[model samples]
Target: MQKVASKRWKLAEKIPPEIEQALSYYPAFFRQVLYNRGITSTEQAMAFLSPGEDFHDPMMLLNMAGVVERLLYAIDHHEPIAVYGDYDVDGVSATALLVETIQLLGGNVTAYIPNRFEEGYGLNIEALGHLREQGIRLVLTVDCGIRSLQEAEHARQIGLDLIISDHHHPLDEIPPANFVICPKQNGDEYPEKNLAGVGVAYKIAQALLRQRRKELPREGFGLDLVALGTVADVVPLTGENRLLVRAGLKELRRGGRTGLRSLAQAARLNLGALSTSDIGFGLAPRLNAAGRLESALASYQLLLERDIQQIGMLVQHLDDQNRERQKITTEMQKRAEELIQEEGFEEILFAFDESFNPGVVGLVAGKLTESYYRPAVVGHINGEYVRASCRSIPAFHITQALDACADLMVHHGGHALAAGFTIHRDRLAELKQRLAKIAFEQLGDLDLRPVLRADVEIPLGELHPEFLKYLYLLEPTGMDNPEVFFVSRNVRTSNARAIGADGKHLKFLVTDGWITYDAVAFRQGHWMEAGLPKEVDILYRFEMNTFNGRESLQLNVVDIKPAGGD
Candidate 1:
């Protein structure tokens, strides 16, 4: 188990007085949070808070004209098109988004989600042959196919026109497809370089809408799916992503998609008041469960399903699959932990197992990164090949590290924090040796403890009602931007008790002399067992907790320590 003292609380930097005093119009403490986000001016702050203030030009992407021309040609010619997508939420959502849009523009389209257990990721030769047999004349890949150089060649050989739309780091050699639209491609200038896979797909749809001279669906008809995939992939919630999510959440609150509405009901969520947490923690997990343990078609269909009965069955089945996936993940995580302890974990960790599922290794790597605060690689050894998934810390870029040793991999690509690759099993030892050396070289002197940064240090008594409302102004925060958190010093824990199933959480009554608040710390029940100090400093966020028809502000404590240190 990780030690509790491993956390470090960092106070936000203080800007110049002139900068802070100039923007005295907004809430002071909340404005400080904006300042921390590099917003020194009121205009920047307003644009960040409000959605739709600025929109990037979709046509600016490199080869946007070619992408539009080929796709439009297929649509006009009435040729069956395939949207080959990954099984994860981002890929599936992009597939659904594109398929629906093409159908709206009168085109024959089918979505294909590669089976994780069989095809792994991206294009496979056998799937291509099948698509050809199914009369798929043109292929449009959503969220995948960037690195399928050889497969793209084979598709052309078989008389298939392939258009790839993906958002992953490309290797030296680009694919041989007709048109590849990725922000990372050379000469591309889409402005926001950090769009999720679904975000890229949405841009294509938006471009197609403009090409047809049609008004964008007022609700961004496809935007709800955008929000689901964007949050699920954990992309930086800034730039165009923030605008899309801000609007998507409003659309989700309307509960228009029958399948998504059923999913909300099945998850026991209030559909009318959805938030980022509902998508990331609640909905995205279920959607990913389908891809992890079963064929992702269930999720892809769920996104488009209008039949209420089928939607209910699909959600119930997905919930069951998610439970099984969780159990397997727990077991694998325990084994991985044992291996890490046995080997003595370093700045970077590598774990391999024949039994590890390729579909779930990313999740395991993510868990390992969170628990150990280090970049991690978890892979499944399949015969002579190992398909590995990597999760990274903010201090290190795992993809760049993989790039440094790219020759050994069959194909490797992904973003900074999360990536995947396939390599010969024999190269595992060399890869480990090379990566450990890189880790030491890159992170030898840097502290690895997780740092929790608070917006400002303020007394609990200073939290006025208006200030709480102002906090909501910074909604849909993730990645680069974070939710509001404040530090309160010298607080007394009036009462502390273990709550939740098996007493895994700490329910406490906290006070700062002037007022008392009901506070709960999830997954921190050990604090109660160790016994809280008489006086302590706490990092917390306020929330409106509803119980028994009553609503009251509650302290969602983030971290705690003795009054002087954290």
Candidate 2:
């Protein structure tokens, strides 16, 4: 196993006096936390903590007027429509959201999610032709097809009307579809640019519902799906995206969706008390497992299933598949790490082999990036072609780098920090060389180590149980909006022991002389082998832990080091 990389802890600067006075009613810690998130005034803090559903007008999206008009006309004319979606959680949930919206609107609609191993990502000529043959007159994509320039032309040639709705970063030129909905596209003025694919679909659903205001099917019906995809896609939880997820969490906890309820039961999560962490670590992975191992159709169908028995069966299958996925990811990540150790870390890491499962290559690449704090590309070589997933750090714009090497790739598209591509196996060497050159140009002079940002540094005694309530104000935290972490230095440790089935978690008691609290450092059990230091510095999240009906304050340690060792 590779040694853990030492992280640099950057503490947030103290809040300015004027802003602190503006937020004077709030606790000092909460005020600092809010300021750290760019909340300056009382209005901004109030709006952030208790956001109202003042969602932006969906019509603001470019081409949304035409797309909604076309869709309403299709409903009136009884035209067949297909919602083409990708196979990941974001894609599958977006597919379900739009399909259900059209069905509720009384339009003849069906869902089309291509098999990952077979059709690959995004819109494909073959899938479009198949949909056209089925007498589908219109195709609307969700969570994909922002870069399907050729496929859009193919659809038009086949006399199929296409509306592309995707949140991925588009290339210099977009598809020639009848309508395109993307905030990042040129000439678009949508305020929220970080929406997940399912989010874009929700906007379409909103526009469709607005047209039939008197016959609105339901309120917040699709927000659960929106929340699932938005969180699963790891988009920034801020602005409108934050409001959608907050409302979606409420909808999810209501247990209206049978498939999601069944999934929650299987995952041992209390649906009534579900949080974003549960979605990110528990439910999203299970839903993604179906696509990662076999086919995502099962997941898409589960979301729409009304039968209890069928939902149970699907949830069980997903659970089994998720377990298998974990095994495969662990093995593949080990192999990738071994390869990196043998070849040494490059500007960007690459590990490709025929034996690597295409389904889990992205996961392996993510693991490598996380372990080494660098961009990583892991691919599966199949015959003459290699398909790869790239995970990158902030220093590098992964998609732009791929764009620099476009001539060497079959096709590629994704966000700045994550991307996917396929290239002829023969040109793999040139692609790597070009990509490394691009990465080195941007990242060679930077300090590339991982950073752990703490909102404040204080004595452990100052952390009170009442502070937990203030922390709860920042719910639905992920990606850009993160959970607050604190740095407590010169803390003494005692009763240290390795816990967990694999003995990979360190459990101990920590104190700053006056106040003592139980702390757990996950995956830090190796510290015991080296002898636990009597004095240590820890960066952790302070929260309440309930064990056997007893609730007590606990410190969830994120990183630990010997006191004053730096």
Which candidate leads in TM-score? 2
Residue-wise lDDT of candidate 2 within 1-566, one digit each (tens)?
24446988899999999999999999888899999999999999888898888999999999999999999999989999999999999999999999999998899999999988998998999999999999999999999999999999999999999999999888888899999999989999999999999999999999999887736545778999999999999999999999999999999999989999999989888787788989998999999999999999999999999998889889999999999999999999888877777656467888898989898999898888888888999999999999999999988889888988898888998887789999999999888878878877888888778889999888998888889888888998998999999999999999999999689999999998898999999988989899999999999999877665577889999999899966
Clashing pairs in 2: none
Q: Which ten residues in a row have the lowest lDDT in candidate 2?
A: 212-221
Counting clashing residue pairs in each candidate, in order, gives: 0, 0
All-Cα superposition RMSD per candidate: 1.6, 1.4
Model 2 CA lDDT for position 215: 68
lDDT of model 2 at position 536 = 96
Question: What lDDT tens digits, residue by residue, belong to model 1 across residues 332-445?
Answer: 998888777765658888889998977789999999998888889999999999999999988899989999998888988888889998999999889988988999899889
